[model samples]
Target: MRRRVLNGEICKRAACREHDMHWKTLERILTFTEPPGYRLSQPRGSKVDPFLPIIKEILESDKKVHRKQRHTAQRIFERLRDEHGYNCGLTIVADAVQRLRQQNKEVFLPLSHPAGEAQVDFGFADVLLNGELTKVALFVMTLPLSDAICIQGFPRECTESFQEGHVRAFEFFGGVPTRISYDNSKVAVGKIVGNREREVTKEFLRLKSHYLYEDHFCLVRRPNEKGHVERLLDFARRSFLVPIPRVESLEELNEELLRCCTKDLRRRLRGKSVPKQELLNEEQQRFLSIPEEQFEAKRLQTVHANSLSLIRFDRNSYSVPIFQSLQDTASASMRSR
Candidate 1:
């Protein structure tokens, strides 16, 4: 074909069209008198090739060290140059290190959360409160099976916020989840008894008892057990709290969050044929009924009003009735009232 194209008997286009060969290949073929024998290309050597064992050893040892103390690509490159007399660009070392680390990276198994099960968590974001930029804690409750979420903002994350968050979430969801997963937050967990057992806080116990929902606390330092809500917290902050919502109070901010959560029900998530609301409706059928009794969420403490008609609670002072001043009025100490 090359000879035919070159001999002028046939045009290069015609020869290439008939032979189904590329123009560049025909041109190369025409440069040789006959077909060249096949030759194998030799592999090229790399400056870091000799130090691969050392690099692997360093990476292996890194597994036992603190993650922040692990050697970065730049540090590895510097060590190779200084200690092993390596002469290579940082790009090569970085590429090699990244590839090796990818090979050794941890993998996670796919998880499935059942209907009527939920995960709870808290995150913080900046919101405009009364025209001032204020940081607030966001309480998030997510139904992992349906990907439904309920978010509310609070002045702070405390027992009050935690319990109130659950109450609001249950009301918003129209039912209580059969089981709820949580981290070992101090508001919920009084002590870590063992690998799995927990000494739950009194407030948490009261809330759970009122709601009649099973509570599962994740293992200490292992947030991945309830990773669904963990991821949703970031999503909620970025999606719902972005642009720094301007509100008059935490109540107003919570109202806005409720609207956002309600609007999100219309979204059709990936791999789902129906909107989130439909999935939530189906999940609600499996959920426990919301109790008819209203739950009082507060902390109780015994205190005596001082001579100045003041009582201290949670590091702050409040005025009591003057008649109760200088008296050990335990009733006045009930913040729940």
Candidate 2:
């Protein structure tokens, strides 16, 4: 309005009529270069101000209790009225709670995913395998820096399958990541000793020894530490396995998954200039070279045959062949217990 009036495009009366403002307001707008911001003469005080300290203490104490047992706005209002003799409306208490909670909200730093670092996780998807709708476990590995991903389907998520997934992922990536993050799955961690300490399984140790890559296990129930793979697991399921794939075998399904991963490498992500493949190529330069010898993706265990010629493994019983004699393998006088 001021620009039009001052620039002689329109008269002040016409400008006021066009802007639907009173002549005084129009004159004020013309007088000043810009509208001054509003100011309160005096800040308003709330009835709940006297009980704010007690409210803060209650909210602080609520943090130590179970989330389900925490105080709601109504409960806090009742406490303020009954316990502290606070005679304020529920709206005020609720508003105060919301404001305090917002002030006390947790803040997280942005994660920096350096090159040659990856995260591993598992997801599940339903697929038609051999004409049967089967739920398959998907082993997902993602290079966080590159946003490159590799996925393979397995019949079950066992230690053998877990090891095999790493083997195939390393082969697909053309090199092993220098550092890899994983959840505390039994396949890798035999036992968690303490914070950041793990008693890794023998097979897991063997795999790491062969690849020469450092292992990082996430904290108990803390999946966000390796959130890259966790999110990509869902991405793989939705983008690659959507509409429920139909394949004759797990091998066939894996081929399709590999193709999808390769094709996805051509896509340029939001904040990146180059395609994911270029980033992956750069990341591979920092990766550990593949070992000369291959790592076996299986577990070895020795079990004795029982009196009924049965051997027990993984909570299931398997019968020993009738033709094979335990006597020969066992000590001459020892019983086959």
Candidate 3:
């Protein structure tokens, strides 16, 4: 009886044997009422990804061409097939480029700037001064680590204008950054002989030396490297210039900009209690300082002294002294008569 019960075949008493059952038999008797929680699906067939190679080819060809000429997808595709043996349909190439561009991640590299590293760039804005539509170019500079910005307005964006703007910004900041980043403007870069080396202008080189700072040119067509100044320029145009649509003079415009950038805008967001001016102060402590005596940045040009003792610049006649050398370099002198 005990053996039968232990084996789960029958109970101790013969009368109870009807209730005993094998564990395997009981499992077989039970049925599941609920269906499976998940269903398995088969994967579909793979489509041909012909655009992969086309995309790679297009990117390679684009890297070799200059930016000014490589504006459209059709142009790039044509170049790839004619020059690089990339035999693909134009639509396919265009689609590939679109996909690659969407998938491409912006690669950011760590840029190190010493205490005095600065970057400069130009920005444009339109204003109505005295009910007259006026367009002006604003020059902007940034201390990378501190994020301190300096901005000035110029009548034009010529090399002379840039040179003067830099001098004014340095004077306002009271020091020069150790290293400055600049775009490949005609004012700074003279010519690009090969793909690698560039011949910069003489005056630009002089400015760099005078400030005791090294000048660096941003990569051709890559403006993101100098994003600091770009953002600052936007801030300045919107914050300072937009509010005051008209000003009596450039000096007045600059004065208002300084006040806004330093005083009002410097205040932290409401309830945050973090002052922008305090941040600039800390940045200044880490910034590079100018030498004992400030370098004099002069804009000298050779001009002919006319009978009226006037020198001409930008079609505007400026009066000079009669005794000055006629064909020699003279400091720009202005006389209102």
> Which structure among the candidates has the greatest lDDT?
2
Candidate achieving higher TM-score, 1 or 2: 2
Q: What residue runs in model 2 are displaced by over 4 Å at the alpha carbon?
A: 1-69, 322-337
Q: How far off is residue 268 in model 3, in Å? A: 4.2
Each prediction's whole-model lDDT (CA): 0.89, 0.91, 0.69
Ten residues in a row with the worst lDDT in model 3?
Answer: 328-337
Ranking by TM-score: 2, 1, 3
By TM-score, who's the top model here?
2
Cα error of candidate 1 at position 26, Å: 45
User: Model 1, which residues run further than 4 Å from truth?
Assistant: 1-65, 71-105, 304-311, 319-337
Give the per-residue lDDT of model 3 (tens digit) for 265-310. 3656445456655655665665456666554545556789788888
TM per prediction: 0.68, 0.77, 0.60
lDDT of 1 by residue, 13-100 (tens): 8878888989878877888888776645788777778888888999999999999999999999999999999987999899889889
Off by over 4 Å in 3: 1-106, 109-114, 193-197, 268-274, 291-337
Could you tell me the lDDT of residue 280 within candidate 1? Answer: 97
